[model samples]
Target: MTCARIPTKYGDFQLCYYTNTLDKKEHLAFYMGDVSEADDVLVRIHSECFTGDVLGSRRCDCGEQLDRSLQMIANQGAGVLVYLRQEGRGIGLLQKLRAYNLQDQGHDTVDANLLLGHGADERSYSLAARILEDIGVKSVLLMTNNPLKISALEAEGIKVNKRVPLEAPVNSDNESYLLTKVQRMDHLLQFAPPSKPIKQRAL
Candidate 1:
């Protein structure tokens, strides 16, 4: 495990890089503030989401989660954000876009991927676990709504002390998408109670 100081526009952060034998891949972790010990760390293993993250597409809540995690870690004054480069759930951008095309034809996210000759999710977290170990994080309060992330990290011997949920505001365009995530993807989302209807202003 080797640590290097990475200078970013936001701030200078300590990055720990390491190679994983099991996955045969290299991984990195961006450390914020002081996180030398185990129990005192807050971590977020963020998978890459290009459409929502970079293009601000309303397909899913990826960008929102990323923003929320950054803000949360900044507020905590100490934490690490392990940004894994697993784009499109590890299917890469091309297949992801193809899946999006299928999705536009009324297919669900999972079915679209399956239709495109891909699995439900092609992501792997072994590299993330290795990176965390390299940084000496024994335990962490994981910021995510995905239960699979918690289980994956725990399986790799990284102690997940707690789960910090990141839920975004649901809108008309993304209501069904959110429902699919909660039901199909097994995300931890407590649906907000229906609010009083607001009167529409006349044009």
Candidate 2:
């Protein structure tokens, strides 16, 4: 693992890179403060969402959640954000875009992925656990609404002291996507009426 100092709007962080042997992809962890001996350290295992995070797509709440996690961490004074390169829940960007097309044709998020011949979520948390272990994080206050994530990390032997819900306001474009997560994917998120205009442009 290699690390370098990174300055961001939230605060200064050390960006650590981990090279994956199985898939040969690189993952990153952005963190502030030492968590070597800390229990219940704030940690967010965030999967990469190119469309949402980079493009600001409103079709999913990923980007907003990422921002919220960082802000919360900054406020709390210590945290780690593990950025996994698992675009589209591990199906990669191309298939995710294909899934989006299926979604536009009247499919929910999970169904769209299934129709594309991929699991609803192909992401695994063992890599995240490895990253956390490498950085000496023992237990975490995991920032997520996905129970699967918490369980996956626990299965990988990373102790989760608590679940910190990461919620974002619904917009017209992402309402159905968020609903799909709650209903089909068993994500612990509440749905509300769209509170703002959809900022997503067609991909």
**Maximum-lDDT candidate:** 2
Candidate 2 lDDT over 1-203, as tens digits, reads 78999888998888998987877889899998877778989999999999999999999999999999989988888999999999999999999999999999999999999998999999988889999998899899999999999989999999999999999878889988987787788888755323533344221
Q: Compared with the true structure, what per-residue lDDT tens digits does model 1 show for residues 79-172?
A: 8988777888888889999988888899888888889888888888888887777677878999988999899888999889899988876666
What lDDT score belongs to each candidate, Candidate 1 first? 0.78, 0.89
- What's each prediction's TM-score? 0.84, 0.93
Q: After superposition, how far is residue 144 of candidate 2 from its true place, in Å?
A: 0.4
* Inter-residue clash pairs, candidate 2: none
Q: What TM-score should be assigned to candidate 2?
A: 0.93
